[model samples]
Target chain A: MTHPKTRAPRVARIAGLVLVLLTAVSGCSSPQKWDLTNITGIMPQLKFTLTDQDGKTLQASDLRGKIPVLYFGYTNCPDICPTTLATLAQALRKLGAEANAVRILFVSVDPARDTTAVLKSYVQAFGPQFIGLRGDQKELRYLTKRYRVTYGLGKADAHGNYEVSHSSAVFVFDRKGDVRLLGRGTDPAKSYTHDLKQLINDN
Target chain B: MQRIHWQKHVSISGTHGRGSMMLALLLSCAVANAAPVPSVVITQARVRLLPGNLPLAGYFTLTNDGSAPVTLTGAISGSFKQIMMHRSFESDGMSKMAPVAKLTIQPRKSVHFRPGSYHLMLMGRQQSLSVGDTVPIQLQFKNSGALTVEFKVVPVGAQ
Candidate 1:
């Protein structure tokens, strides 16, 4: 029974309220600020104590103050391991002296086959600065579970011929030892370099 | 075909003139066309140099030029104690290597065995191998017979 002019004002008021509500909802669901997928809080604890390429027992805490790029792979991995390590080497080469600020950790999931000496030579072949880490199956399992890494061994024939499947993503940790970014094995070296530079600047 | 064509032209030139030359040219063309082409070709054979006792990775490209498909059953290399075909795959962030029993290539197709995909795992080096060294590997195929190809040893970081 209201006048048309009065009803128009009332409808406008309701529309204005609806518009404000929509803006609030949209703002609450805003996209992340970083280019890479944000996995900041996914893994809260990145602690581990494993043996390095030098056969020395090292703790993750020992690598503080330097950004660590972690990868889970084995030496016998003819494809992904070499490819990923090569990509990382390329990125480090592009960074030049800045590469020293970052540490590359190649965690061998195949502890049975990849010995410290084997890992040392394998990782050092890519870059002398690269550190190879390996541990027992239980220790590796704990670390893999903490980082959500999955790895399994293929069935071996009579000739001791088998393959190990593992995760290929490179987990980048900041100087503070917090997981920051994830780099894929297939990503170009430039992307890794870019991310590392940004992380260096941020840290 | 070229040898036969040359002999035919020489005899024809002694007997006849332009007409005989044209006939000889046509016959040579037909013979050349009928010649069998190479059914399979291997290219880009290279091996990665990994230090210590780690297995080396060999990569190559196999091209089939025949009308029928070809299956690569296995490979043998005297330089390594064992050679096996393997494929690398990544799914849901997990990277895995699986044994490739046999790979079949379609007619007129090529299968690339590159890094992070398919490769030959050469294990237990028989002798010390270094960069610039050439290792002979024999590829066994189902239809195209065995092909012995030389895989040049490349640096570990080389793609």
Candidate 2:
């Protein structure tokens, strides 16, 4: 019943309203600003199949929907390993309930010494939510090479005392299982908490 | 006894604000006179208790107030079967631990054995240890004789 010219302005106004609403919604869903170094496209092969602390096989795809904070160390490492785990625990504690959505994977480079039982006790000493993983030498070599992690076994003494040198960086992946950030072992817990919260807030 | 005397002297001097300069001189003199043999004071000594039979890490601050430099050659602990000086470092993203032969501290200087630096690797626990337990350790120095101290066992993740 309305004239064509009158209907044109009404439809155009409605279309404009819909467009404005869409823009606002999209803006709200946009990714948050991350202080960590962005390595989205440069991420290496993140897929893996390893033995978890429970002696069951787990695939990397199983952790797809959760953000993963990965650290490569051995259970026998006295200083840096424990220090990094402690820092991660403190950061997760600061995140409170949101930490439940995050997964901490501690990959042991010394599979020969760190059995599933040893890994479980070692990782659980830091936090109950921490999961320990260990793979055979071949599997570890593939994953470590893909992640650019370097590790070497120290010379054993006459008494069979030895050490394993491994990487200390904490690599972080987003909810979509994409590598997002590289956190250093020396970073403050506040920085880690901020970065994790930002990742949790992002889609 | 000596700390109390030093505090009393400082407080009495503080009552007379103009005597602050004399207080400084007296404090230096007190320090010089208090220098006993093996004048190495160990503070904040703590050992991280690892799970199972894993080696533990020890950290502390050592202050030398003697007239000459001192070298910490080794350490011994009753709770651990073997104790050795080790330095932990991160180079090119790889964490490395190497045995340290000795740590030399100059006179009137302090050396801090922290998490990422010089530490004592206490290997092979003789018995189970938990948080709040104290382990007796002795530090053998080249010049300052041996100093025995108690290292409190801390959580594995303690800094």
Candidate 3:
């Protein structure tokens, strides 16, 4: 609405100032997180309280403000459970000092066999840093449901041998208590590590 | 069959629409001398193959029918760069897997492998693997000499 000459110069001056400000702020801008954008879809919501291996009561909230890799299985479990945990132990050892910041949680789906004492020995065999947790059947069901993890109880035979069929997905929780991503299987692969590396870098 | 001693069932939840139950994992611990043992058949044998890593892993069970000790040492798998026997151990509460001289299979005894415990390391993967793929492996024992074993490709979380 104003005169052409006056309007043109005013607009130019405003644009020039905006460019200068952007240049000044760009240098101080923070690096964007790759994990946040890549794995934005599968956020996990899990919270439960159970007895720890040390016989102390604990809750999911206590694990807040740190990255945690959690799995659900039994101690007397013949194969995959132990195999996966061992891989985690190997992975953690490879992580060295950085591993200190990460907490690996072993949630016992078999509450009947996994008493606090049983969990203690089982987790201790995997890694000193591992935390084994056991709860009543109702509590375990609630917690597993929150994570969308599936598991089954097998029927007994005359000889009394039984097996447990369970989901082998590994859930990763960020420091903010958001379930960021899932690494499929009992043990992760290089791709899993790559994804994990991305999540760690985000922190 | 009479020589095989199966352990009792343990209860646990099931996954994959396999309803909750008290499942049974049959194990044979007895080694018989008077009776001729039935040869062990390890079905659904497979390894979790990791690309670019040496010494991948293979897990299976020992079913004895001949009633004698067998030393599993020599093995050949086209999928791996190398094949070897290794036992994974948990020490100081940390998991450690290392190469071993041999794995002894007692007469009429069966050994099982799962994650974080005893398993066969594939050493290295020669090709890429997918969820539904399968790789063939050959296992050789000190006494059995050669065994053609095929390992099914399973999810990392599969038992």
Residue runs of model 2 more than 4 Å from their true location after superposition? A1-32, B1-36
Better of 2 and 3 by DockQ: 2
Higher-TM-score candidate of 1 and 3: 1
- DockQ metric, candidate 2: 0.61
Query: What pairs collide in candidate 1?
Result: A166-B95
Worst 10 residues of 2 chain A by lDDT: A31-40
**Candidate 2 chain B, poorest ten consecutive residues by summed lDDT:** B1-10
**Model 1 lDDT per residue over A1-203, tens place:** 76998999999999999999999999889843544545776675468999999999988899888888889988877778888899899999999999998989999888898888888778778886599999997888888988888888889877786778788778888888899887788988888888888888775
TM-score of chain B of each: 0.75, 0.75, 0.66
Candidate 3 lDDT over residue span B1-159, tens digit each? 122232233444457343332122221121222232235556557665332232345677766545677776756778766665656554432233455667777766777755555677554467877657878777666644556665777644344
Candidate 3 TM-score versus the reference: 0.50
lDDT of 1 by residue, B36-119 (tens): 233677778999888766788899888777788888989997888888898888777788777899999899998999988899
Global lDDT for candidate 1?
0.82
Give the residue spans of candidate 1 off by over 4 A: A1-36, B1-38
Candidate lDDT scores, in order, read 0.82, 0.84, 0.63
Q: How do these models rank on TM-score, best leading?
A: 2, 1, 3
